[model samples]
Target chain A: MKYLPYILKHLRKNWIRTASTIAAMALCIFLIASLQTVLAAFYGTIDTAATDRLITRHRISLAEDLPMAYEARIGAIAGVKRTAKTNWFGGVMGSSGGQPDMRNFFANFAVDAEPYLAMYPEYGLTDADKQAFMQDMRGAIIGPALAEKYGWKIGSTFQLESIIPPYRADKPFEFVVRAIYSVDTQKYPNHARDMMLFHWKYLYEKTGQRAGVGTYSLQIANPSQAAAIAKAVDSTFENSDTQTKTETEAQFVASFLALVGDLGLILNAIGMAVAFTILLVTANTMSMAIRERRTEIAVLKTLGYPSALVLALVLGEALVIGLLGSGLGVLMASTLIGNLGSIPGLQGFGSVAMSAGLAAGMFAVGAAMGLISGLAPAVGAYRANITSMLRQV
Target chain B: MAAVDVQSVRKIYKRDSQEIVVLDGLSLEVPEGEFVALMGPSGSGKTTLLNLIAGIDRPTSGKVIVSGTDLTTLSEGPLAKWRSRNIGFIFQFYNLIPVLTAVENVELPLLLTKLPRKQRRERAMTALKIVGLADRSHHYPRQLSGGQEQRVAIARAVVADPAVLVADEPTGDLDAKSAEEILNLLQTLNSDFKKTIVMVTHDPRAACRAHIERHLDKGVLMTTVERHDVAAPVGAR
Candidate 1:
């Protein structure tokens, strides 16, 4: 640690060179963290799965529906606890005069409410709340995050009138916000955060569209029994005009992401490139520093500083530089994630909160940079002869 | 016991299969607490002999022993430690670390010691006092005159209390007055503190002050003179 002051002094003396090199390291680290944020946002979605839940959709297409009567037959399965259904409900908000609004929110159709609640208890609804939602025909629930996003209040008649169309772009559906809830978990069981749901009967009866339901959300009696119940649900719809495909909610979430995003490989490639660039810049700085000090290092050796101590000093210099640079990078990266992640172009990925895992990974990378930077200098110092070194002056 | 023992020591330089013999079977000895001048022409292997005795270089063959430890026997790590503790080197060009102030250069050797920072500072000041440059301790080597730089080099050399002081022409780069002052300081360190001093030089006037003068010719000590001898031919005059 005594060497720390010496290192700092050297850095200050070579201010421009040292500053530029550190800036490069910081930029690379910021890039790495930025890429990781994107990957984390996408992976965070898949991780928001519920084992007790299963999704039963059309065998051939996600847009297709089955008879609402199948919910009861599926619920009757030995390991099935509950079943409900929802339509895709793709209506986005439209401003007056036929112009589309920019805000994005989840829109879903539901008839049997209890199963949706049972399968996704992370929605933060209690039994009493479920009973209230079940009893009210015009009742609607929204996540607090979503409520805040759209300025909706409980007991207020919020216009889905702008967003949800009644089978035509010319008409709209409206609802009264009955409850605003937050998911108890960090991730949502269905939408992570941006979701709103209500009684499907209101939309179903008006359209006179009796195409059954788009998808059944199922809750199993036992998590381990999910596979058997999924089989039963598919078996029930097997012979019908529309067959079913059922999967655990986690698998469902993954498949949904696979269909919508190219994140799996993109995140990995971006992460590797970021790490590699940082390594290159740091190694270059270290090489220059060592090369310039060949004679000074020889002086220290002749002065009897142990070769190992000299090596440690160089490594410590690199570590301090890396930690400062990367720490600054993580600070900027977290801000970008928190403030910018919910923009219209970035909305589906949700907020990017800095996690302990990310901090630990950055720390390990910083230490590895230190080790890499010290290697060549240490070898050079070890090989130098004290007499010739003194003669160098 | 001899503070330095050079026995059949040979140093050769190889450049593209050519052998340049800097020292061929050179041998010399110096007992404790003696002020010995190794005088010769520029290519006379004087500095080479000093380096060998200072544990800074290995001979091509044979042995160099200092204070009972065989120089060629110790590995590099131990040899560097030994040099720092036992040998104080004064270079002709002063060779002060440019980044360091006078006091810091003096403190360099103590960095290898277990002394506390305050104590190292105190000892560095005392060494500067020994060279009469305690007032210039804050100035960097570049700011000092050639003589002052040499004095700082001397402070740095003695700061760690090494057993032997090896000066390869300390006054070589100084004016006559400064050179005389440097010679007087070296004499004091010898008679007053009983330090073992070895200096290599071609200057006969500076050579006149040493308690003993030794000549290295063709990698061999030809003679040792304890006092000025009028009958002998002048080595350089």
Candidate 2:
């Protein structure tokens, strides 16, 4: 601790090199943390899935729709409480050519609003909003992120063109924004905060094409009996034309992620590559710094500093770079995560965040990067022969 | 007892397969409170002998002792501790750490001790005062003149109160006037503080300031001369 000034002064000797090395490290940390946060949001949806809730979908694929009658049969299964129906509207707003550009897209769901809202207590919907949405056939409730994005107020009306073939209206469907829903982004992934949900009956009355629902979300009375109820629900529809697959919400989300490819492996591979690059950069800089100070190091030895202390001083310099660089990077990531909705093209990741545990882990990675990078130079300093080094002077 | 003893010391260097002998069967002794100068040309092994006495290097085949400790027998760790306690070294380059202020450079050797930082700092100031550089304590090496830098180096050397001071060309890099001032400073350290001093220099005038001058040729001691007239403290004359 008493030798800190000596080490600090040495770092300041080449401020440009030191600052660049630290900046490189900070960039690596930011890249790795952002990639890891994306993976966490994907996997976190599974980990935080409701234990007592289950989703029943078509056996062949989620793209195929299931009849609304299936919800009643699933609700009759033992340990089943209630069921809600939902459909992806695939709506594109203000499209001149009637084509869906992803940039102008927000997830819109035609849903049995009461049961769906009851199943997700984390959404924090008010009774007034729910009653107003129930009274008007064209009323709609949008996520706060979507509302802020389009600058929609409670009484504002908008038109959406259906992208799906069967539900495409000759004249665009009009609806009034009844409420802007609130969600705790820290507690839930951004998917819920970046969506709009309206009544499924309105879609049926407007389109006149009853294509049925995409899935049935069932609330189970007991989490322990979820597996049994799922099995019973699947067995009841075994011989039907649209066979159903029932599982806990967690399993459903996990399978959905699996279909999207191995995100965890991809993210980890990127982190390792970035870390290796940063390690080489920092090591090269430290080697150059130490090489330039060979004579001064010899002088220190002549003053009776042991090889061990020399090693410690060199390593301490690298460690400070690592800690400071990573700290700055993580702080930047936290700020970006907090204001994700305001950043264009990053609005979908409004719920992507760095947790306290994940932040601690990132700091450890930075420290490890520093220690590993410093190892070779520190050893060189330790094994330096004082007499030979003095001869260089 | 002799403050320094080199008994039949031989130092050899190996470059590739060639073995070069820098010192062959060298034996020398300096009694307590005596000042000696080693005078020789380049490659005469004067610096090599001084390094041996300061415990910075080991003899190849013989024992070297300083301040009651057999330097040849001590391991690297203990030898460093012994050097810090008993020997102060000055170089022709001044060798003050460029990043540290004058006083900080002087305080470096005391960092090896258990003294509190405040006492170390106070002692460093006193050493700077002795060299007449107390006002320049906050100045770095590059900011000072060559002569002032050497004074700071001298302060650093003696700040630990080592029993012996070993200098290799203490005035080698200074101009004529600065060289004379540095030689006078060394003479005062020896005559007043009673420090056992061994200096290696090619300058005849620097040698004349010491109590005794030993001349070496090709790694062998050839002559010893005593000069009593210039041995008094520089202030007295």
**Best by DockQ, which number?**
2
What local lDDT score does residue A212 receive in model 1, on the 0 to 100 scale?
Answer: 56
- Docking category for candidate 2? medium
Badly placed stretches (over 4 Å) of model 2 are A90-108, A125-133, A136-196, A209-211, A222-241, A259-261, B231-237
Each model's lDDT: 0.75, 0.86
Q: Number of backbone collisions per candidate, in order?
A: 1, 0
**DockQ numbers for every candidate?**
0.43, 0.63
lDDT of 1 by residue, B178-202 (tens): 8977888887776667678899988
Give the per-residue lDDT of model 2 (tens digit) for B66-163: 88889999988888888888888998899998989999999999988999999999999999999989999999999999999999999999999998
lDDT of 1 by residue, A1-393 (tens): 445667786777678877776776666666677777666766666776778788889899886677777777887888877777776665455453555444453544555566566556667876666677667777878777667777888776655542434343235667677777676553553345666778777667656664458788887779988887788779877888989999998788788778335765775677678667767777777878877777677667756676777777777777777777777777777777776635654554453566767866775676676567656766666676666676665
What stretches of model 1 exceed 4 Å from their correct place?
A44-48, A63-70, A76-78, A87-112, A126-178, A182-214, A238-241, A259-262, A388-393, B93-101, B132-150, B171-188, B202-209, B222-237
- Candidate 1 overall lDDT versus native: 0.75
Provide the DockQ value for model 1. 0.43
When summed lDDT is taken over every stretch of 10 residues in candidate 2 chain A, the lowest stretch is A95-104
lDDT score, candidate 2: 0.86
